[model samples]
Target chain A: MQDDIVLKTEDLTKHYGGVHALDGANFELKKGEHVAIMGDNGAGKSTFVRQITGVEQRTRGKIWLYGKEVNFTGPIDAREAGIETVFQTLALADDLDVPDNLFLGRELTFWNWLGPFRFLDYKAMRQATIAGLEKTAVKIPNIKNTIRNMSGGQRQCVAIARTATFHSRLTIMDEPTAALGVQETEQVENIIRQLKSVGEPLILISHNMRQVMDLVDRIIVFRRGRIVANLKRDETDGQDVVAYITGAKGDDVADVA
Target chain B: MAETSHGTGGLTFDKSKRAWPNELNIFIALILIICIFEALGQLLPYMNGQSLLFDTKGRFDSIFNEARIKIIILQVSIIGIIALGVTQVIIAGGIDLSSGSIVGASAMIAMSFAQTELVNGNPNPKAIFGPWAMDLPAIIPVIVGLLCGMLAGIINGVLIAYTRIPPFIATLGMMVSARGVAKWWSRGNPISFPTEDYAWIGSGMMPVIWFVLLAVLFHIILRYTVYGKHTYAIGSNEDAARMSGIKVARHKVLVYTIAGMLASFAAIILSAKNLTAQSGMGLVYELDAIAMAVIGGVSLAGGRGSIIGTCLGMLIFGVIISGFTYLKLDAFYQEMVKGFIIVAAVVLDQWRQKKAAAKT
Candidate 1:
């Protein structure tokens, strides 16, 4: 239980029947340290994240967040514990507008003055959403328009903005720019950079080598359900990370030089 | 940013040129249908100068035929309650075929509790219980009906949510099972001779009043509450909703339970209105309610509709049926026309959805 350790997972293992999706993964993230988890498809990077975020329960694991041992039953539990996540699907209600999507599970509601009736504080939520968007520099033409009407880039920005809206202790993004265009991807990367400047810890899961190399303080590569390499940004290049991802390097430790 | 078009399903296609909202489109069609009926009344030789719904004769208290108006509203009100629940369910991306059967079961069970101790000067022949159960309070019967509906709904919700069964299959099973329960309750016998207290539940325009009140309440809930937001979210994208921390399964169950309770309420109204209840009381009511929601612009694909739209659709339904009867159309022909209208409304909704999709 160390205050400096933002997130720590000990021997996290997830088994889908007899198949091992993620196995005995040991990982750690320091406060305000931007980290990347990179691996090829089916290399269990997503599975590992899912377990940490409580999208899927691990067979055995102990997750500590902000120096407190926590076991999330589902994504909601993880979220309530101050772990904000932008899932691969973006997890946005497409029929809802930008503000509504931003406040999907966490809405501003007040009890009726006279009765037991509860009312959603749409005006307040809208203002907060605007302020949050401005904070992240994620702009949309209209917050009234539903997500279905927005372009791909706008939808992604809204998703990322939602994670930023609340003061999350740890933010996890799974392939945040996978479907984004060059400009949209750049926009997302800038938001990530803003998070770094604000001294916020981040765990970004991506296959984009350039993105991982450019945005993170460290890279953790996964191969066949296990963490194969943990390399500091100053000590690793794209070739070394790719080799680890492709399982060309077997050792868990890599050269620091 | 410049383009703004009102599309069907309450969606605004900002990039498209222009089109009417689905609700407005339905409204215009409603007026057109009325005009068509009016014209037919004047054109046909058998009509004898009688209008479909207007004050052509000027004999009634108001412009419209008061009796006909009463009948039309009453005809749709009881089932309208069920539509409110179904609308929520559909918006949450599920269908309920068990509503009609739930109506049947609830009506029969509620009526059994509502029986008087005496029938026409003799001991109650239709009584399903002992003297202690006779002539009980109206609240007892209403509660019984609601609980029965709630039980059925819970079952439907649990099966669909926890078991991961498709909504269609789970509700279809409930439909059959509930119908069987209705028939078995009194061995297919009809229950009648309710107490005065029970009879007052659906007397006169009470059913219509109930429908309007429930519609308004649910409208507010759907438009200005978290419940409404979650329903739309789940229907729009279940996976996204779950990831956002919605209790998808629990919400599904809650939706179904409410739907069942509404269906049960409809049954109580119907039985009270008729002063009788039989196993066949709610046959096809589910389809009729679904049709109303669809006609009102409720998308079968989920996550796009409104209470106002459904209410308007109910009126349209009532008017069409009344118009057909007034025109001296055969009952058989009316059924076919109703089916056609349902299909046409869905096709219209589809076209609107496609237009919006293309614009974006």
Candidate 2:
């Protein structure tokens, strides 16, 4: 319940029928801290992120954000509560242009008295989109081109920019660079660095050990639905994190339940 | 990169890379078809030369053949109403096969409410209801027709969104059921003798007026409204829409419901204009409406069309029908040629998509 603790979760567990996708995860993230979630496939890394972002319902868990206990019904609720996420799927409407995709769900509207019949404020959204892109130092050749025509890196940058544009309290990204080329990956990493320079808190889920070590202050390793190890970047190496991920090392937090 | 050279304000637009707007392309097609018919009018030997859309002999007050133009506009207007709704449904990535049947059922029900108490100083012989329902206001019948459409749309939306049935199958079921309702409404007999107020709604060029008004309203709605954006977003990528926190299922219901209301409105106009309604009304009208949307450049794939394009498509349909009759072509040939045009439009759509994809 401290002001510095941006997000805290206790006993977060999700079971898909017989499969325990995520179990007994007790985690905490402080303000301005960058944490990396590293695990192999089916190690509950994505599942854990989904639980926090309300993309899926948790079987039983308590999540506290900025000292307030909250339960999200859907992704929208989480987003409204200042939790922005760059999902692994890179959820961008292919036929919509940059501004449209950036303001997809939460569009700015004029004619407030018209209630549900309000019109989209295209000019305002375009301006904000331009500002967001500039803030992230991302250059797009054409803001009017649909996402379908954009390069993979440009799409990824759009998603990241969406998270940044909203001035969210917490940002979570899952495998953002998985599909990008070397240069594109560097561009995404630079965006992340920008977030850090602004003193923003972030949770990055990546499988690349090098990326995890280079970008995050702390690395949380998950193995078989539980937090196996929480290692500081300065105190631990890739081998130590992998040892815990592969279940060769004992659990660092004994009281996960 | 050449396309990105044009700067407006601080941002550059790839205007050169952009193809002509779909609506513009459809408008051009409409003009080309008219020109072809005009050429045929001059080239063919029909005892004497006659213009297709012009009054060469100065028979009318206007420069153009106002009579033929009126006929073309009037013939397409009723069905064009249904196409307006079908365009939205298709843009939302769904199909509604029930629109035509909804039209039939709604027209029959609405006319029953709209009938006068006495026909020429006698009890109405074709009344579907008792005197209590007779001589109702025009708005009563209009609302009744809209409700019929709305109910059918809700069922279609629920089935497609919640039950997860394919839109084609769900709407097809409604299509058959609605047609049955139309027949059962009055034992397959036509309902006639609509009240004077109701009759005025569809008198003469009123249908065309209604079509133009609705087309303009929907065109703006699709272009500038939040509802329009959400509809396009859902059609463009449903998963992305959901992840962005859009209520996909509920939105689907809204889209189908609106489409149903439009179809019902079309039915009301058709029945009022005819001064009667039959169970056989609007038979195959759904296909015509859909054909209009597709021909206008509304993609069957969804999320990539406009109301303007559909309107232009409607005009093309009107021209083809009118042109065929002017050319003295058999009615049967119209069907064959219509089929060819529909297939060609879809082929063109696929080519456009591929070209857009290749540009990136």
Candidate 3:
């Protein structure tokens, strides 16, 4: 397989009126790479993902998707460009059913205007939804159930299924298993492993050191707004990562390598 | 296994669908209203008590008085038009208290345009309008009314969505301002004697027809269309809706605008039916319409209710009024009862919400 950089960000920065929410940051991911971003509460880990995924605009930077420089104005734009993000807040509409939530903004329309008027092609969507669930190996008794009725893990699984169903080129998950219990978290981890086997790139923003160590191939550390250090899974330990998050390193000056 | 998820889930799964038991409260209230009238009929000497639904004389159709039923429906039908718009607003996590004021203002403006020239040479003295607006087609007034509503809705939407004002405050500001405009239009005197064509639009059962038609249309829109989905999405969780790529602000504007237009349309019907426009025509209509929405089972918190519920609520309102007349209840008592019903409906809604939350 040709070595291709599936995603790249350069000099990405965001400022909330002098807060310097995200200072200059640079990152890269290969087509099948699994990367984990680790940082403290105010380390700008979320800020970086928010900018890259178009949840928030960068004050200055360029995001290149598949080698083309991109500036997405909104999350939908990023989604259409094959980037699906599972935000920390779990932006799923609780009122909607599993299938409806899966194909919410991007509803699979049949017969164009004619079918939209007659029926939603629920059968097609349901079948496809089941297939998507099977691919993720996330079992649910029925697909007709709403997110409000589902467990936290089940809801998280449904959210992940959306990414899998769309076949997004890159998936950005922010604390996907934080709120989940042991069994549910294990289920999510298995799904993550399945994604790894499928050669799909994933960017996991997580604080769980064990999860980060187990699921990702590379660790990218952030302090304040800039990327402080980059380490491969085998090369670095958790203490080294924590030292950077705590700003113990004297590398305060941001010099892009 | 220890229960470790968000909530306990093991329970007997009942296949029979859960009914809105709150609807039963409204039903019980309806029965109680009938009993009140039945008791009053026993004490009152004037009340004949020939039938609960029929008129005083107890005649099947004629003496029973179709006009009374028509009047109650007619009264509600006009404001019910505004309610349709308000429903959309509420569903989208907003409110439109200005709808009633929009009605008053739009009625005055539309009537001014729909004025007829004194054909018999009486020199129409009540004419605040010029000869250019004289004897225009009925459609002219309707279009004008609709436009007025649209303008009010757009202003409310812009203020709330773009300016980031709270819906209640924004629409309340419009409410006061619109009513002020209504009073200023003819300077507090009633605008009388609309053109015959204008009068025909709201005359007889037309208001009811329009109300029903608009309600049905909006009901479908809320249930089946992209607009409907977006409305629920925003109402349920606005932040999530925005993150989902919905143009939240623009859609909000459209929803409020639609509401404003509905109010204006009701205003047109009101002025036409009465053949007169008054500054106080739509006073207190906002409350009544809101009461109807609440009584119909619409959750005040938003994202949970139906148009069918509103329609049923309107029917209940009509029935209660009719029932009071059957028992020869005082007008003051009827008002008191209506007030109580509104409060009861809200309480029932709260109870239902609590139940749902408990389930979660």
Candidate 4:
């Protein structure tokens, strides 16, 4: 338990009735460090993320955030504990506008004494949304337009902005650029760069080697439900990471029980 | 910062691109329907050219036929209350087929509690309970009605949310069960002789007053409250709502429960206004309430409607029903025409959705 280690998981395992989607993932992320999780399809990358974020329950594991052992009941619990995630699906309510989607679960309200009858502070949420979008240099033609009308890139940006807007302690992105075009992908990468500039810690789950190498300080490769290799970005090449991912190379460290 | 257009040739803020609000469109439809009926009043050779809404023949002091207007408003008001709740359910991507049945069951139960000890200086002949239950405060019966509706709603919500049952099937089950309860409550006999206080609740345009108040309250709730936002969010994308940390199951329960309470309130008003309750009360009223919501522009697909639209839709229904009678149309023909109108409204909604999609 050290202040420098932002997140630690030991023996984290998930089984879907005999299918071990994630197993014995012993990992650590340091304060202000960006890490990439790379694996082939069904290599347990998303499953590992889900376990950490409490999107799914872990069969056997321990998670420590900021050096305190914590268990999350749901995504809301993880979020309130200062973990923000941009899921692979983007997770935007299509019919809601930018501000509405940004503040979906955690809306700002006035007339607090009204309890359930309190009114949404539309002006405040709108202002914060604009500021958040500007922080990531995301351009949306109309913030008032519903997410249904926005381009794929705009929707992705909004989801990312939501993570950024809340000033969350840890941010996680899963395949954010998988569905974006070349230019949109660069736009998302720039947002990640902004996060690095602000010295915020991030965990990115992606398959693109070049983007991973460029954006993160460390790369954690997953192979068949285990962490096969942990490579420092400056000391390893894409081929080395790919070698571990495809099982061409053996685990660099013993797989934890 | 230079705005990057992302190859869209620069995003243009075209005023014309903005579609008219759905509520405005509904309001316009209401006016058009009224105009059509007014034109028909002049065109149809109905006993020497009588006006439909206007007192053109000098039948009343006001420019409009005050009596006909009152009747039209009064007829729609009771069901309009139910439509308010139905609008919320539909907006949250759920349906409440039990609302009409809830009305029937609540009316029968509430009236029994609201009964006076003596009917015209004699023991209450229609009393379902002994003197101990007789002449309770009007609030007691109202609360009884609301609790009944709330309980029914909770069952519907739990089935849909926790059990993962489709809203249509869950509510349909409640619909049948509630109607049975209504009949079983008094063994299929009508309950009458409500206390004077209870009777005053539905007397003389009170139903209309209640409808207006509830409509305004719900309109604000839907437009401005956190509950309203979650309801719309859940309807728009339930998984997204969950990921955003919304309590989807609990919220569903709340929405359905509120809808049930509204339906029960409508029942209370109906029974009080009639001074009696029958097991047959509110038969097919669910369809009428849903029709009002649909006609007002509440989408069956959910997450894209308003209380204002439903209110305007209610007015259109009232006009159509009143207009048909003025035109001397048969009841069966009116029913057929009402069915056609409901179908047409949904078609129009689909068309509008497509057009909106195309614009983007």
Best by TM-score: 2
lDDT of candidate 1 over B53-163, digit per residue (tens): 777765757787777889999999998999999999999999999999999999999999999998888998888999999989999999999999999999999999999
The interface RMSD for candidate 1 is: 7.7
Q: Which ten residues in a row have the lowest lDDT in candidate 4 chain B?
A: B4-13
Q: Order the candidate numbers by TM-score, best to worst.
A: 2, 4, 1, 3
Q: TM-scores of all models?
A: 0.89, 0.94, 0.86, 0.92
Judged by DockQ relative to the true structure, which candidate is superior, 2 or 4? Answer: 2
Q: Kindly list the per-residue Cα lDDT of model 1 for residues A1-257, writing each as its tens digit.
A: 66799989888889999988888888889999999998888888999889988878889978888888888888889888888888787788878888789988777888856231367899899778777776677757666888888788888888888767788889999999999899889978988988898888999999899998899999998887888888899999999988888877866533221
Q: What lDDT score is found at residue B208 in candidate 4?
A: 98
Which stretch of 10 consecutive residues in model 1 chain B shows the poorest summed lDDT?
A: B4-13
Interface RMSD of each: 7.7, 3.6, 6.2, 4.1
* Runs with alpha carbons beyond 4 Å of true place in candidate 1: A1-3, A9-26, A57-62, A112-117, A224-240, A243-252, A255-257, B1-21, B59-61
In model 2, the fraction of reference contacts reproduced equals: 0.58
Which residue pairs clash in candidate 1? B3-B14
What DockQ, between 0 and 1, does each candidate earn? 0.34, 0.47, 0.26, 0.41
lDDT of 4 at A179: 94
RMSD (CA, Å), candidate 4 to true, equals 3.2
RMSD of each: 4.4, 2.8, 4.8, 3.2
Q: Taking the tens digit of each residue's C-alpha lDDT, what string does model 4 give over B235-309? A: 999999988878899999999999999999999999999999999899989999999999999988888899999
Off by over 4 Å in 4: A251-257, B1-19, B58-61, B121-123, B358-360
Ranking by DockQ: 2, 4, 1, 3
The C-alpha stretches of model 3 lying farther than 4 A from their native spots are A1-3, A11-24, A59-61, A108-128, A140-142, A224-229, A234-257, B1-50, B54-72, B119-125
